[model samples]
Target chain A: MTKVTFIEHNGTVRNVEVDDGLSLMEAAVNNLVPGIDGDCGGACACATCHVHIDAAWLDKLPPMEAMENSMLEFAGGRNESSRLGCQIKLSPALDGIVVRTPLGQH
Target chain B: MSRCPSASTLEAAPIVSETVIIVGAGQAAGQAVASLRQEGFDGRIVLVGAEPVLPYQRPPLSKAFLAGTLPLERLFLKPPAFYEQARVDTLLGVAVTELDATRRQVRLDDGRELAFDHLLLATGGRARRLDCPGADHPRLHYLRTVADVDGIRAALRPGARLVLIGGGYVGLEIAAVAAKLGLAVTVLEAAPTVLARVTCPAVARFFESVHRQAGVTIRCATTVTGIEGDASLARVVTGDGERIDADLVIAGIGLLPNVKLAQAAGLVCDNGIVVDEECRTSAPGIFSAGDCTQHPNAIYDSRLRLESVHNAIEQGKTAAAAMCGKARPYRQVPWFWSDQYDLKLQTAGLNRGYDQVVMRGSTDSRSFAAFYLRDGRLLAVDAVNRPVEFMVAKALIANRTVIAPERLADELIVAKDLAG
Candidate 1:
């Protein structure tokens, strides 16, 4: 099983099992995590799913596409490792990736 | 041409943080932030916004927010502390003046050059302002933001003579609420009906009769050419030179995407930022969603910009997934809803390209559903206070299946039973 770690803004760590085809965003939503709203239900329209991906795995994920990059530009508390979680799909290769949460959203 | 200063400094910074930076806070912005956290991404996230308040919904600004039924706190997608607990660092009332796409850096109005690996634009849409004579009169108002709603609510002091220019959803919603509060309302529409282009003829007629019955003076096939008054509008002149009494005038022409920033950055822009099914823009490393981006929705069978909360939230999720390299081309049914005059109108799917329509229930009953069929396939369903029918009709649109007219008209069959 693919394993992913989520470090909330308050420093709470949660480990989750992920199917190869499921997205990181889908995994979090399915597990009932609170920080990510995913209001658009994985559409690129809502920026609530912004996440800071672990830098070590940055090269493992594909480069930010035009649409995803444009949206990350609007996320709250943006950072260098900032990425929308829905844009990251779990894979066997990215089995041990970790991400952090931002501080404010509105 | 003069450029916003922060944008220029953006090129110098290198994106090194684990958090994502989202500029322009709005409904789409808020949804993106929430989705990122829910998706198990634990990194420092920053949201820069030009507005001072937290991201709240705008649809209710014209309806419940204006009517005072929706409290300001309820308007919030989440309480302010919720974002704090979520660890979303929001810089409000601060604009991103410059963007260095090459460097993946953003320059804020305060001259902070921050870098971002991923950038999302949830800038949302804005109200198309009027430019007619006396359009700037203090008495004239345009509804789009929270401040605009607050001003209109304050102006709606009992017995105010409110003149609503452009009898579309916004104007009609205000009219309905104002009439109930004992304010004399006049709705001016250029089309013969209040909502001609947006809804079916029957739907438009239904709203017209509802407003008239409520004692709202709705003038169809009329245009306001000029507004006259020193500070506030005192009178409005029509295309035919007819003058009408007015205390406050609200112009509800429509909304356009906040695409100036994106356009300046050399991103492709059609009527909106054109995105494929996954909400990808033409440029590499950039994605546009929400009202600012237009996608060829398989559900609509046409390129369109959806301004509903549901659309924005769903699209935001798809964009996040695409960014995660788990791209599933967004293919979801489109749904929308509106409330006016105690009547709730819900729609699933696009009614365009429909050749035939069958009324499933009685409009006279004040609760019914209209099934729009194209080539014997269900295209859309407009339900008025009929949530049950709306659900099944949504399934019907997704399935593209046909329902017998007899079964549809029979309430005994019920929506759930027809699902079989």
Candidate 2:
């Protein structure tokens, strides 16, 4: 299991150990971290799972796909650090990755 | 008159002693539990479900779960520890046999009675089964629960002949998976075309062609007479006297809302359990949500009985807020999606009463969006392989935005700009 940290908008931090091959959204959702609602169940259809990657670890993640980029365009508070948690699958190389969720997910 | 409680009121006076009993553990029930806790409702929460397992998502059951790409563990709406951590008492594998509105008590099938201050009925719906001869055959199946899909998956052998009744999303999705898995699949639809009730003929044609290209035979305007078979072999008898042999028959005709309990209690049920904007049933202190409800839609100015994850989650939150005395109207725009053979069809708003359809991009490229308009107002949009259009259209529909047909169809204009 790889360790992942989720920082809520209210500054509550939750560290979860997630199995490899699972998306970061699953990691936070499985661990019951608030804010990141993967309502689409990692289908990347709903932008509810939007998250801002910690700037330092942003480059370590894979580039966003076309579908993710399109969906992110309409996500609330889109920014350079913004990515859908469902699109970011956790791997051994990305151990101890950190991300922050928005105030509310639409 | 009871004044609606605001956030301040809830924080100041939390009803910790009251008990909230939510029936039917599905997506809506799961969301209501989370929302109740989030809304500061520290009341006793009891979740009773007829299913043996915890609340799990139903979308993947037709696509990934049936295809073997998604595991059963991932199907759960939350981990096992979530209910425990959230202080939710779950009674699985039991049904609510009776509801006493006057007494505010519910009797479970196991002969246990529980009283509650607020009751939420998220009973959802059941798969509409085919009613005909041999419909009770063991080889026949429906895709509504994990158990239903498990039965279908076992019959999905590589060379097996799979007959699917009803060409709706569920049937087509299963067809896609079975075809990819090397099974011979066929779809029979009683309507003139597949997806006739949900989308336009153009969109339906697109899907029909896609399924045909995937080596699945689609028979439209065909009626099934009965199923005739013995132990080792099964055959589907069509209305025209042609008998088609099949190893397994799966039906996805539609859903029948589980409103018997609510109706028996005299809660004013139409096609579904009737609820007001606050998700309150005719009976005071009783609420209903998800596919089992025919709640009012402020966007369309009509009552809708939707069967989608979006409706389930949003209505669950609305019901929770109302139960906390923070009454808020449930008026979010309805949206739905379907996946088949790398194609994602995302729809927003209701296409009912549409007068014209504006097409964006080209169907030749297999990526396009169809905008439905009534009196020049955007009523809905069907986006196929067009995520950008789907997202923007949802917002535009919610805002009731109006745009010219030419502008909506122009590919040069960015989708986001069209919103303005």
Give the number of the best model, judged by lDDT: 2
- Candidate 2 ranges beyond 4 A from true positions: B1-6
Which 10 consecutive residues of model 1 chain B have the lowest summed lDDT?
Answer: B1-10
Chain A TM-score, cand. 2: 0.97
- The most accurate candidate by DockQ is 2
Candidate 1 — which residues are off by over 4 angstroms?
A: A1-106, B1-17, B404-407, B410-412
Q: lDDT by residue for model 1 over B257-375, one digit each (tens)? A: 88877787777788888788877777655667788888887765678877777767777777665555445577766777677877877777888888877787777787888888777
Which residue pairs show collisions in model 2?
none
Scoring model 2 with DockQ, what do you get?
0.77
Pick the TM-score winner.
2
What TM-score would candidate 1 get against the native? 0.76
After best superposition, candidate 2 residue B261: deviation in angstroms?
0.4
